[model samples]
Target chain A: MHSRTSFSVLIFILLIWEILVNLLHIPKFILPAPSLIIYTCFSQAPLLLENTLVTAVEILLGLMISLAISIPLAIVMFSFPSVDAAITPFLVISQAIPIFALAPLLVVWFGYGLLSKIIMATIVIFFPLTVSLHSGFKQVDPDYEVLFDLLDASFWKKMRFLYWPAALPSFFAGLKMAVAVATIGAVLGEWVGAQKGLGYLMIQMNARLRTDMLFAALVWLSAMGMGMWLLVGKLEKHFLFWLNDTKN
Target chain B: MLRVCDISKIYSDLAVFTNISFMVEKGSFAAFLGPSGCGKSTLFRVIAGIESSDSGHIEWEGLKLLNLKENTAMMLQKDLLLPWFDILDNVLIPIKTLKRDTKTGESEAKRLLSRFGLSGFEHYLPYQISGGMRQRAALVRTLLFDREIFLLDEPLSALDALTRQSLQKEILRIQLEFDKTVLMITHDIMEALMLADKIFLLSHLPMRIIKEIDLSNLPKPRYHLDFELAEMAENIFFTLKGELINA
Candidate 1:
């Protein structure tokens, strides 16, 4: 019921937008109708697909890099207080610093290639993953700690059996968050400096005043982000199957 | 024997309990009963070594238990089962924690689950089971921990009257059949009277064990009835009622 409402609301908004643009004779460059944007999507399919692939690569690579670093970092942060204390300030500074400013620096150091884009997305993705997972680890019931402490468990064994599974729901929450923001990082990187990507294509089209094509790029970019988010949701439902089972 | 000696806990200059001490003989069920917020739970935590007392020592089988001791299996009112884990896996938590072989623990967990009337629900989550069943699963987990002593913090108080009665029987079986020493903390005078070989009635804050009722002289399986049971229950009730009035 809720999803149906949302779908119809979206359709309603697009219809109003198309009609207003056409009825008012708005310039296509100034404000392309949704119909024109949809037309541009099919006409420039190959071009959009190529740049979509580039941005998609950046987002996926960034996501993988973030996951690789964050999961272990989260585990260590939970295991060792000293590590948590030492690493927290740097983590805060990383998030506090704007990605836009870092993008130029990233471009300068890693060049206007996929490396810089991937790194850009990693910077955007890392904090949420680590913080969410760390918070999840912290949220485990103290009763379970007594159980572990009584068993004379080593930190690794506890993390493997207890903390890891306990923290997964929140870790997936972080991953979904990362997937949503990852496009921003990838696109922003391309906007700052990139040889190829949807952001680069959008920038090029904007300069040429191809507003319909620009909107088409946006449609695809958003679709990619939405697709990734949905994928993460699917993965979460699959892996954290017990959460749903518990709700029943 | 599990012995707590000169145990005390003070918070911000207020005494939660002072010099509280008790002993439970091996294979005996001892209930530490007191009113709410009388620091009964704190004393239990001290014994379990989950919380450090202001000054105390707990000796289990002649070894001082400074931190968490492997000799005791503790359960709380909440089952504390990992909700994400199925019944069988939740029961194997101690096995997983001790880094023991799962292949062996799995079969043992199955046997125990079947014994506890959770035979077909091995794959069910905690929320899927009834509250009584969840607690029973937790009991199975505690048993699988396979410690010589069980530290229970109102482990069955959350259930309905019917379920609580049955679990009381289960606790008795654990002590009598398994021969594990049990030190349980509860507020219900009757619950203590029924299962505990000794019931230690506690005072209000700055709590002390004001009275220790020895039920060991009574016959096995007290059944929550009998003239002596009512008499002792009434005795402990008035004692706590007097304390409540005093407070």
Candidate 2:
């Protein structure tokens, strides 16, 4: 029902955009009609897909790298208060800075390669993942800890059985946020200095007065982001199946 | 036999138990009855070795229970069924957590759960079951620990009246059949009367065992409607009310 409403609203907006472009005599360089953008997307499918795949790789790799670093870091921070105390203020300070501002520096350090874009994506996705995971680990009810103690469950056993499961729903919540912003680092890095990706294509298309293709690039970028977000949601549903029945 | 000697706990400046003590004989049912939030749960926690007392010792038989976890199976008021686990897994958690052999866990769990009408729901999550059923599953999980003593912290207090009554019978049967020493905490007056061989009335803040009523020789299959039981419950209620009123 919600998707139907969104689809109808999109169609209505596209129809209005198409009509207004025609009536106002809007040139292609200024604002291409939605239909023209769609046409450009179809005509330039191979070029668009190639760039999209590059960006897609950067995004996935970025997500994987961030997951690797942030999850363990979150675990460490959760397990040791001294570590958490040392790192948490720094984490907060880092988040306070505008992450995009570091794109030029990242490109300079990692070069104009996939590494730069992947790092940028990782940066964009790291804080929320770490903070949410840490908080989830802390969410172990004191009572449940008592239960584990009564069972004489080892620290590793508690982590594997209790803490990990308790942390998952919140971790997935962080994952959703991470996936949503996972594209930011890749696209920004491409804009700063990259050989390939939809971000570079958009920049190039913008320079050559290819506004239609620019819009097409945007369509693909948003589609990638949405795809990732939906995939994370599906994974959460698969893993945290008990969440639905938990309210009882 | 379980002996709690000079057990006292205080949180900061607040006194929870000054020097509380009680005893439960082997193969007997004991209930600690008090008003809600009267530190009975805290006392159980201390007994289970999940928490420590400011001053005390708990002895099992003739030996000091340095590690209370090895001897006691506990069920909490909330069921504590680990919502993420299936009914069967929840039942087997103690064995797994204690690193016991799981080879025979499935059969034992199935048998216990079947006894509680939870057989078909083995794979179902706790949230999918009724509250009473989940509590029963929790009881089954506690039993699977294969311990001689059961420490139940108001295990049936969250259920409906009928469910509470039914579970009371189940607990009593389990105690008799397994020959387990069961120490339960409840605020319900008649419930203590119905189930326990001895009921200890408690008063908090330097918590004291205000009264200990021994019903070991009381007729079996005691019911709420019994004239003798009602009088006893009334007397206990007044004693609790008097404690509350005095404060």
Q: Top TM-score: which candidate number?
A: 2
lDDT of 1 by residue, B1-247 (tens): 7788888888888999887778879899899888899988877777767777888778877888664365778899999888778888889988887767999999999998898899999998888889999999999999998888888999998999999999999889878988999989888888888888898988888899889888888777776658888888898999999988888
Question: lDDT, candidate 1, residue B238?
Answer: 95
Poorly placed runs, candidate 2 (over 4 Å): A245-248
Model 2, B1-247: lDDT tens per residue? Answer: 8888888889999888877778889999999987666788888888887778788788999898643777888888888878788999888888898777787888889998999999799999888889999988988888888899998887887889999889999999999999999998888889988889999998855578899999999967897889999999889989999988876
> Residue B205 of model 2: what lDDT?
57
Pairs of colliding residues, candidate 1: none
iRMSD (Å), candidate 1 = 1.5
Q: Would candidate 1 be rated incorrect, acceptable, medium or high by CAPRI criteria?
A: medium
RMSD of model 1 against the true structure: 1.9
> Candidate 2 clashing pairs?
none
Per-candidate DockQ versus the true complex? Answer: 0.70, 0.71
A85-162 per-residue lDDT for model 2 (tens digits): 999999998778787789999888989999999988988899999999999999888878877887788888999889
Task: Write down the worst ten-residue block by lDDT for model 1 chain B.
Answer: B63-72
